[model samples]
Target: MKTDPERFILENTSVLSPPHVPEIRLHLASEVHDLWLKTEEDLEEIGLPPPFWAFAWAGGQGLARYILDHPETVEGKRVLDFASGSGLVAIAAAKAGAVEVLAADIDPWARTAVRLNAALNDADLAFTDDDLIGRSVDFDVVLAGDVFYDSDFARALVEWFVNLAESGCLVLVGDPGRSYRPTAHLDPLATYEVPVTRALEDSEVKKTTVWKFRQ
Candidate 1:
C-alpha cells in the first residue's frame, strides 16, 4: 500500500449514514465522482482495486435495513457477512444482537474501511480476507450484498451459498437486480428503494431486494 489505508480513508471520506439504514453510519467517500475517477487512476499506481468499499452500495444498504428491522433473524446467532464491503451488514448484525459477526472481503482496503466504520458505530466485528467459498462454514447465518455483479464470481458464490443453506445455515443475499443473481435459488424476503449516487449507478434510487437462499 502506498499510503496508510486508515489515513487515506479518513481523509477521503466522511462519516455519513446510508439513506436506507440511517441508524448505521459509515465512512464513505464524499465526492463520488472524484473518488471514482481517482480510483481508476490509482488502479495501477497504488495497486488499489475498485473502490467498492468507499461507498454505501444499494444492496448493502437494503440488507442492513432488513437486518435492523428484523433483528430476530440474527439475534444470538453467529453470522458471516461475505464480500462485506464497508462492513455495513456485519455492523448491523452485531447491533441486532448477533452472538458474533465476521466481515470477510478479499480487499485489504475494505478490511480497513470496515474496522474504521465499526469503530464509528462502536460495533464489535471480526474481519477476514480469506475467500471462504466452497469451504465449510460454521456460522448460523450468512449474509452477502451486491455480490452477483460478475457472472463467474456469482456462479461460485451460488454454489457455496447453496451448500451452506443445505447445511442449515440461513443464507441471505441483498441485490439490486443484478443480471447474475441466481433468482431460481432464492426466496424473496424484503425490498427497498435504496438511494444511490448517480455517478456510480444508473439511477439515483435503486430497487433493491433481500432474498433468502433456498436449499
Candidate 2:
C-alpha cells in the first residue's frame, strides 16, 4: 500500500467507545466531515479504499452489545466476524469467551485498524483479507454487521449465509434496514436504538436489529 495506514490512523483518530457498547474502545475520527472527505480524496489518489474503520457504525454497535449481553451465544465456540471494520464485533466475541475469533475484511486499511483496535481492548483475534463468500468453513458462529447495503453484494451473501445456517453454524447479522437486507431468513434476536454519526447516516440514532439466520 502507498499510504502508511497505522501512522495515518494513529495521527488522525481519537480513542473512544461506541455509544451502545462502551466496554471496548476504538480509534475513531471525532470530526468525520473533514476527515471523511480528506480520506476519500487521499485514498482515491493512492488507490486505497475509503476508511470505514474510522467510525463505530450503528450495526456493529448493536451486534457488539448483543454479544456482550448474551455471552452464551458465542462462549466456547469458534467464531468468525465478517466485514469486520475495526474488529468491534470480533472483540466482543473474544470478550464473551469465544474459543477462537477471526475477523475478515477485504480492505488493507481495515487490517491495520482491526489490529490496533484489538490491542486497545486487549482482545485476541486473527484477521484475514480473503473473500469467503461461497466457501465452506468450520465455525460455530458467524457475525456480520452493517452489510447488505448493495444489491449485488447482498445477493451473494444471502446464499452463503443460508448455507452456513443450514449446515448448523449459527449465523447472525445486525442491520439498520439497509435496502437489500433479506428479512425472510432472519429470526430477530434483539433490537437496539444505536447512536451513529450523522455524517455517515441520515439519522443520529438508527433502529438496529440483530438477527439470527435460519435455514
Instruction: Report the C-alpha lDDT of model 2 over 99-213, residue by residue, as the tens digit.
Output: 9999999976889999999999999999999999999989999999999999999999999999999999999999999999999999999999999988889999999999999
lDDT of each: 0.91, 0.92
- The C-alpha TM-scores of every prediction are 0.95, 0.95
Model 1: lDDT of residue 57: 90
**Pairs in clash, predicted candidate 2:** none
What stretches of model 2 exceed 4 Å from their correct place?
Answer: 41-49
Top lDDT: which candidate number?
A: 2
lDDT of 1 at 204: 95
